[model samples]
Target: MHDQARHGGAYIRIHVTKQGFDPLTQRLRWSDLEQVLDTGPFPDEGPTTDDPILDGVSYSFQVTAPGRTGRHIVYAVWRAGHADQNYYMCSDVRFPGGAPDPTTPPPSPPAPNDGCTAAYTPPGQWTGVSRAR
Candidate 1:
């Protein structure tokens, strides 16, 4: 997630549910929501102040899925410390249980100097997404 305006610290709340999100209504079926998977406050990597003109930050989390699972949706809400607004994102994930398959290898690490900047100007866009460089 990209904080374009360099807003101060923020809190991230993640909830997992079997409920699927509706694109037409822009809502999620909360009936299957049992509990929140994880929550964390951000700007943990550094301090935030109004001094700098631009402050961009990113955060990531590793959450454990339920043992018995088929398909699930993870919702993340980002609430800025100084703002009353909240941003939302939903991700669909699946867990197929059985023996682990060796054919599908683990995810590889991000390449060095991939153009992800922590502060200041926006980092370069994802490679090969656009025609213009």
Candidate 2:
């Protein structure tokens, strides 16, 4: 998993493979992403194939919290085209006051949560739609 930050907030841009880069930090940033989701518990459950997904396309993702009262969570599952570079790793994501307990997820999305800054999900079960950059 990879990460990127913006708007004075911290978020993770998980990539199935290292593709993009952040010019400043000089790190492999996320890019060409297609879909993203919050997988934690109940409101933020996880590892379910039922989770919505984009097709075999190169996708980019990131997690961010713009203010102090913000909580954080793990933004997982990244797809990088049809190439299978499945390496496993994790991010040391932190939030407002202090880093949240790793055992628990920050919170569910739409709760002041920043959704995918990219992608276009059209009406009626958005299955095979491509978002413009």
Model 1: ten consecutive residues of lowest lDDT: 18-27
lDDT digits (tens) for residues 13-61 of candidate 1: 7777743432222445666554564454565354344645656555556
* Stretches of model 1 off by over 4 angstroms after superposition: 8-10, 18-27, 38-40, 44-55, 98-133
Q: For model 1, which pairs clash?
A: none
The CA lDDT at 8 in model 2 is 15
lDDT string for model 2 (13-114, tens) is 332322222222333344522223432211111223332352122223354434422232323543222243223344433344643345754343343546
Task: Give each prediction's root-mean-square deviation over alpha carbons.
Answer: 15.8, 20.3
Q: Give the RMSD in angstroms, all C-alphas superposed, for model 2.
A: 20.3
Best by lDDT: 1
Score candidate 1 by TM-score against the native.
Answer: 0.49
* Model 1, residue 59: C-alpha shift (Å): 0.7
Against the true structure, what is each candidate's TM-score? 0.49, 0.21
What is residue 112's positional error in candidate 2, in angstroms? 40
Candidate 1, number of clashes: 0
Residue 43 CA displacement from its true place in model 2, Å: 31
